[model samples]
Target: MSARFEELDWQPTDLGEISLRRRRDPSSGADVYEVKLDDDFLMSSLFTEGEVALARLGLAAASGDPLDVVVGGLGLGWTAEAAFQDPRVRSLLVVEALEPVIGWHERGLVPASARLVPDTRCRLVHGDFFALAEDPRGFDPDSAHRRFHAVLLDIDHSPRHVLRPGNAALYEPAGLRRLARHLHPGGVFALWSDDPPDERFLSALGEVFQDAEAHTVRFDNPVLGGTSANTVYTARTPQP
Candidate 1:
């Protein structure tokens, strides 16, 4: 059996102290990997249904084949892994603010890291996602103003509850409009939220894109002995 608890990596970043830890789950008898920013629990391998669903639902809304995708967070690599499962995805650009998190993947410290690091289709970029979204140059560094078929985001806790106060702007109408410019017509944008669906946020999305809807992804929580839910908000650019 693996050690009861092991902290694989820790780094102090501008965001805060970020750490990656692995622990044995007594109930499942499996090792669980977790990422934390300071005292806030960011992601746990045990509860990744929402993250996977974010990619699945977002890509499902996309209309074309050979999709190019941009994922805004690289926590544990679940979202990017899930996106790669779709054969239609030709390329994946994952924008992460913390360089340490990218190093974790490159060093193969996380479960999905081994698969993600060797894949030529995946490119992990160290940059601020929100800042990139607002930039006219967009997510791709080499290709300016590049557009993607889908953008799956799991960075903040929710539209209202953000890790950084500056991130809150991305949820606003003006911010959403800025992000939309980086999408091709009929492209999709999906976001994962720890909180329940927020109608006000949905309204803001409606202003920026067509067919904006919120999906509640629920999963069993052994620790709570009940079900827990997270929200995935999906929106698509207007088709010509």
Candidate 2:
């Protein structure tokens, strides 16, 4: 048994004060790891079904063997871990804005780190995901204009509700078009949102991709008692 509550790590970045904490859940008798930005709760290990589903659904939509993937958040490493579960994932490039979060994984502070850090297919890069998405060079630092089979994003709360105002651009039609350039034809782009499906965002995706859909992932909310849901939006690039 560990302490009731312990802050694993904390750091100040341009985004805000970010912290990682671990606490014992009395009801489940399990350790729960959480990440927070200032007072805002960013992610919790207890509710990761949506994150896992983001990668699963995105990869499922991609049509190809030996897929290359780019995950645009490193919170708790659930999305990246889930991506690796698919044997088709030949490489995974996880872009994180905060360096401390990457350190947490390299230092093995998070449970998923044990599985992710040792995997040769996984490469954790410390960079702004939104900036990388808009850049022509794309997510890979060494390879310019590199294309991937899937891009799974779980950084913002929703297309309308973003952590940073600048991030909102990525949800727009122009930005969507720019991101599509980094995806191979028939590639998939999936996003995890705390809010319910937004038709406006779906319409924007439709303008940029050949196909788009929203999936509602429901999971038992242990703390709140009832079930809670998150949305995963998947869009596929046009095939040749």
Q: Tell me the tens digit of each residue's lDDT in model 2 across 1-240.
A: 989999999999898999999999998889999999999999999999999999999999999999999999998999999998898999999999889999999999999999999999999999999999899999999899999999999999999999899999999999999999999999999999999999999999999997799999999998899999999999999998
- Candidate 2 lDDT: 0.95
Clashes of 2: 0
Q: Give per-residue CA lDDT, model 1, range 33-104, as digits (tens).
A: 998889988889999899999999999999889999999999899999999889999999999999999999
Candidate 1 is scored at a TM of 0.99
lDDT of each: 0.95, 0.95
- Candidate 2 runs further than 4 Å off: none
Candidate 2 local Cα displacement, residue 219, angstroms: 0.6
Question: What are the C-alpha RMSDs, in order, of all predicted structures?
Answer: 0.7, 0.6
